[model samples]
Target: MPLRLPPLPALRFFEAAGRHQSFKLAAAELNVTPSAISHGIVGLEQALGVELFAREPRGISLTASGADYLSYVSEAFSLIAIGTQRLPNHRADRPIALSCAPTFASRWLLPRLAGFRARWPNVNVSVDTSHRQVGFPVDGFDFAVRMSRAPVAGTAWTRLFGERFVPVCSPAYLANLRDEQGNADLRRATLIHVNAASEDWQAWFDATGTEGIDTAAGLRVDTIQLAFEAAAMGLGVALGRRPLVDRDIDNGTLVQACAATIASTTAYWLVSAENADRRPELFDFKRWLVSEAEHFDTHANPADQALQSTAN
Candidate 1:
């Protein structure tokens, strides 16, 4: 017997709208207009001979029937997704898509990626670097590395590491700052500021008990990467995050200008949608990321080494 069913497009539209509980959000997820979503839901309701949503002054709400139908629809989609993921060839050639902050990508992750590639030669990885907050499935990102104090809502989160900030400058710049008494006077130095990380400098100053250095004065750059580069070029002293500037300090491009370190309230987090763990590749990637973060925290303490060197 031939089976009768609602239009696939209308069903898909209804599923999206019901899941999000907002037509506008559904439209964004489906890459269509709100009007189209409304029309599709209307057609779906007509086909089912029931009202799926109730029109209201502020927005729309799901009717009793719609809520019941949504449970079944959502379950069906989850089953389909899980089944597809379990297929033999599903992970064979598909790439893992990741989103990360630009400075973290360039300064921290990029250096370690070759190791990941070497370990998992068959698994291809693609990274997108941006400051915009990722929206998981809606934004088409498999997962993200975010700097935050806590876990993001509606996602599974793993804390990676905390941030430690220290003052850094080129060796030549530090040498030039030394007076006849051998005291490095930071008030006379040009402070390089990261526009987004203003608190870093303030915290460093408070920790070091230094005073009268103008926080507003400096060559302001938009990203930590640029600020580090400017400081390495002998422009001025820049507050450097430990993880990002570890290599630069080791390589002698930058030196610690101050011994005081400030521990940030926030830390790095690995975030992904609830369903991301179902795929074996994503699971493997997550485990690998956690391992790498642990290793970094254990072995990468350039800030401490820098302070010790200065004391000696």
Candidate 2:
């Protein structure tokens, strides 16, 4: 008996399109036209007797079954890649490829990476800050740091730490918001909002029972880093995520706007490949990352906790 398989070219197109979720993007990556991708996908689906993608006005999305199939396909491809790299002629160097959100990389990871480099001088590491959702080994990343409320399936997830959202502003700006009672009042303050966490303001208001402020009206920015920068610039009171703001508050760049903190529902997590036990570098990095997180939690600013309450 022979092993049954679909056309290799058809599977290639499905893999690329599945990874990107866009025929146009997949076509560009493969140096072909969108129509070619579409045709290839159609043929593959017909042969399998199942629709792999849901075509819509905005873009395409993988069907539930298709998504499940993709994981297996991607794993197979990754095995081939890994085997090829192990060939005698292949380069001896294999860097630990890491994928993480931009803000996380800048504010938290970058500051501590020097220590990792110092410890493992011989091990090379590469960081990618793309905002795209990675497809595991298909994306060539050994590990990823993502923020999520619940662990997503199909990958190994390691819980990091949760962030508390608190309103922070320049000391000068905070002084202006002080009421006659000398307590900071947000009733008349300009709220700075990070679009990624647009609901932070509402959630903060709800959780803390803070009244009389409009959560919708504010200076809008795309990223948490930008929102923090705006708050530091005295533009307005922006909700700041912990650890990210710890340095700013310590340096007097920003201060607590009010004493009512709300914990974010999402926690930072490290996702890794299922077969990561084979990679010693990944294990070493994971251990170091977890240790740093624990140390951070143990030594969280006790003084600031009392002063920093309330959020975006």
For model 2, what is the error of residue 184's alpha carbon versus the real structure, in angstroms, after optimal superposition?
A: 2.8
lDDT of 1 by residue, 235-271 (tens): 9999989878888988999988867676788899999
Which portions of model 1 miss their true places by more than 4 Å? Answer: 1-92, 301-312
Per-residue error (Å), model 1, residue 41: 19
Per-model TM-score on C-alpha atoms: 0.70, 0.82
Q: What is the lDDT of residue 75 in candidate 1?
A: 66
Candidate 2 lDDT tens digits, 12-87: 8899899989998788767899999999989999999999999999999999989999987887888776776556
- In candidate 2, position 13 carries an lDDT of 87
Question: Model 1 — which ten-residue stretch has the worst lDDT?
Answer: 131-140
Q: Relative to the unseen true structure, what is the Cα RMSD of model 1?
A: 6.7
